[model samples]
Target: MCPPEHFEVSYSINPWMEPDKPTDAPLALVQWDRLRARLVSLGHRVDVVPPRPGLPDMVFAANAATVIDGRVLAARYRHPQRSGEEPAYQAWFAEHGYPVRQAGFVNEGEGDMLPTGARILAGTGFRTDHRAHAEAADHFGLPVVTLHLVDPYFYHLDTALAVLDHEEIMYYPGAFSPDSQALLRELYPDAILADEADAAVFGLNAISDGEHVLLPQSAVHLTESLRAAGFTPIAVDLSELLKAGGAAKCCALELRESLPSTERRREPS
Candidate 1:
């Protein structure tokens, strides 16, 4: 995750960004630090990427790349405001010894592509191009299920839907198109459905390590639902980052790769 040292709402990229409104940069950093601490406390190793000037949105590190099985498919941003972040992320991945491939089409990394155990759930209609889905499929050798987004508020798929595990998920049905919603139901019949109130607070922008689900504290109903589903819900305050259309999932990117059994069993402090 990248620090929110340069985070600000100086320009409007999404519906949530209001440039005219006041934003607390120091508070954003504090909230981001707390989030990193929480992840570490949960036995997860947190990696930091140095923040660069003139790239405020770099704090949303999840949009930097999509890593699957040690291969990196770097993001090709649709908006020019975020384009500069691509090189930094690509360089980071390359320097870290991950094979990085530049995207041939406009794709916002994890923002539009969500990898599951079997296939990739890709979103289009706002930031990501539908053609990028095929590129991702060919690159990862996994089937890509295209889902169309209809709501401007939920521009990225991560904002409306989150993968719970290999076979489970939770989402806001209203954010997707009718066909997409139907397809989601057909695929994940037992998925948790969030109400409009919870969704409005970006409740679906969560991270679940199969057992623990971390999300925003304002999503009261989602917390109860998560507990009912036998999952531990860790509520965190990310209201400062929410002003820029992000939360926990936005700031963190999962780097999926094969590891030795011994290394995998080692808990991180």
Candidate 2:
């Protein structure tokens, strides 16, 4: 995760960003620090990337790259404002001893590509290009399932859907195209569906450690649904970061390593 030291709504890249509105940079940092603390308390190791000037969106580190089996597929951002973030992320990954592969197409790293236990759930019709799916498939050596996002509010797949476990997920179906929604239903018949209220608060932008789910505190109904599904939900306040179109999942990037017993494990908490 990258610190929100320089984070601000200086430019509008997504629907959530409002450049005219007031943004509390100090409060954003406090909230981000709390989030990192919460994740560490849950037995997760948090890594920090130094924040660079003129790259406010760098705080949303999940958009930097997609790491699976120790291979890093560095991002090629669609928006010029975020384009500067790619090199910093690539340098960090390379310095950390991870093999970094630059993407041939426009792909927003983990923002558009999400890994399930069996295959990759890739998002398009927004920041990521449709052709990037094949690139991700070849790079990770895994099947890629493409899902189209219809709602501008849920531009990234992580904003509308979150992997709860190896085979389970929770999502807001309205954010996806009808065909994509049908595909999701076919793939996860028992998936938890979130209402518009919860989804409006970016409730689907969550991270799970198989048992514990960390998400926004304002998603009241989604919180109950998680409990009903026998998962522990840890509510956190990231209201300040919400102004910049990010919360728990957006600030954190999961670096997945292949294990001897399994090809790939689910994303970390």
Candidate 3:
């Protein structure tokens, strides 16, 4: 995990960012510490990637890459603001001895790609280019389920949808195109739908370890729904980080797959 020591809105690219808005640096550090402590306390190991001075968005590590079966498909960001982050993350993976494959197409790593057990769910239409989907398919040898995101607020697939275990999926329909929404309905008929109020707070941008779900504290409706669905929902207040357009799941989590036993224990927590 990286600290938000240099996090600030120097420029605006998405709806959540504004050049005039200032981030609470101290509070962001405290919040990040709490998240790390919470994850560690939950029997998960935590690792640190030293934060760089100018790359403020390094705290949101999920945007770094999409790793599966020990192969790293490093990100190629669309926006120039985040383009500088690619090398740092790629270097991290390479130093750890992972095979890092440089991506030719534009993609934002886990921000647009998520492996939902059976198939890979990929998002397009905003930050990630559609050609990246084909690249992902070729790289991973997995069938890619392309879901087009329509709303500017839900810029990434991770923001619009949350994979609950292998079969169950939760998402906000309004963020997706009509055909994508219909595709989702057909794909996961028993999927949980989040209302606009909950979705607005990024309720669907949650992380789960099969049973326990760590979500935004303000998303009470989603918390209760998760409880009813037999999943444990842990509320974490990441409001300070949210000011920069992300929350607990987006900032702290990086999902990888099929690592050697040693690297698996050290890399993912």
Candidate 4:
């Protein structure tokens, strides 16, 4: 039988986080509702899990690890405190039946898993480490482009680079090593350079659903350019989420499936 088409996703209403961090309740609620509506409009079956208690900051939804081919690799967050998140995800995965795998040491979440076609440009430094990249390549059967990050602000790889389409990417030059930059230039000479200001808004955390791109309402020019390129640009507002360092593009998820059986799942690897 074909696996279920519906996806199961979890969220943490309470996070072991800085209580002082400001939260815009109305804005966040609006953003979450829009995401649900967009997914439904695209014909995706979404399963929502209330955020685990005490993981309130889980609203910065990208902390979950990346997954591919049923191998649910857990994330090792950069913030020492955030590392505590993995065990919870692991437990959640076990209960949910997603396979268990872990990123290499000193790593963090899926924000570092930048997919370029079949190639994995795994980031090393604040969020993810080299060992995780190597192991990830082994499990997923893909080549890894190891990027040694130098800046803390650009801790997550997704913050600096993202795949726009199958053959196109959006990247910021300063965030890349010279060799990676050269390689990117060689591969997609026509790829766009995402605006630094916009990337700051975490707009680069765009969703490329194998075709159209789900972008941010704040990125007007880039959104127009994306539409010009034939992508059905879907803009969502995420300002309240951004107050805690999250943007609309980064709030949702990308669910991968196991091959052959090919059923979609919620938990990450």
Candidate 4, 182-264: lDDT as tens digits: 87788779777767676666667677664567767777666766666666668887666555445544565455673222222
| Residue range 86-193, candidate 2, lDDT tens digits | 999999998999999999999998899989888889999989999999999999999999999999999999999998878789999999999999999999999999
- Sort all candidates by TM-score, best to worst: 2, 1, 3, 4
Top candidate when judged by TM-score against the true structure: 2
**Model 4 collision count:** 16
For each candidate, what TM-score against the reference?
0.95, 0.96, 0.93, 0.80
Model 1 misplaced stretches (Cα beyond 4 Å): 258-269
Score each candidate by Cα lDDT.
0.91, 0.91, 0.83, 0.62
Off by over 4 Å in 2: 259-269
Which window of ten consecutive residues has the lowest lDDT sum in model 1?
Answer: 259-268
Give the higher-TM-score candidate: 1 or 3.
Answer: 1
lDDT of 3 by residue, 1-269 (tens): 77788877777778988778767889888988888888888887676777888887888888888888878899998888888888888888878888988888998888889877667899998998999999998999889999999999999998999887765779999999999999999999978889999898988888876677888888989888888777888988888777778887777545465522321111112
Better of 3 and 4 by TM-score: 3
Q: Across residues 158-219, which tens digit of lDDT does each residue of candidate 1 receive?
A: 99999877767899999999999999999999899999999999899998887788999999
- Can you tell me which runs of candidate 3 are displaced by over 4 Å? 259-269
Error of 3 at 102 (Å): 1.2
Q: Per-residue error at 23 for model 2, in Å?
A: 0.4
> Could you arrange the candidates by lDDT from highest to lowest?
2, 1, 3, 4
Question: Each candidate: RMSD to true structure?
Answer: 3.8, 3.0, 4.6, 7.6
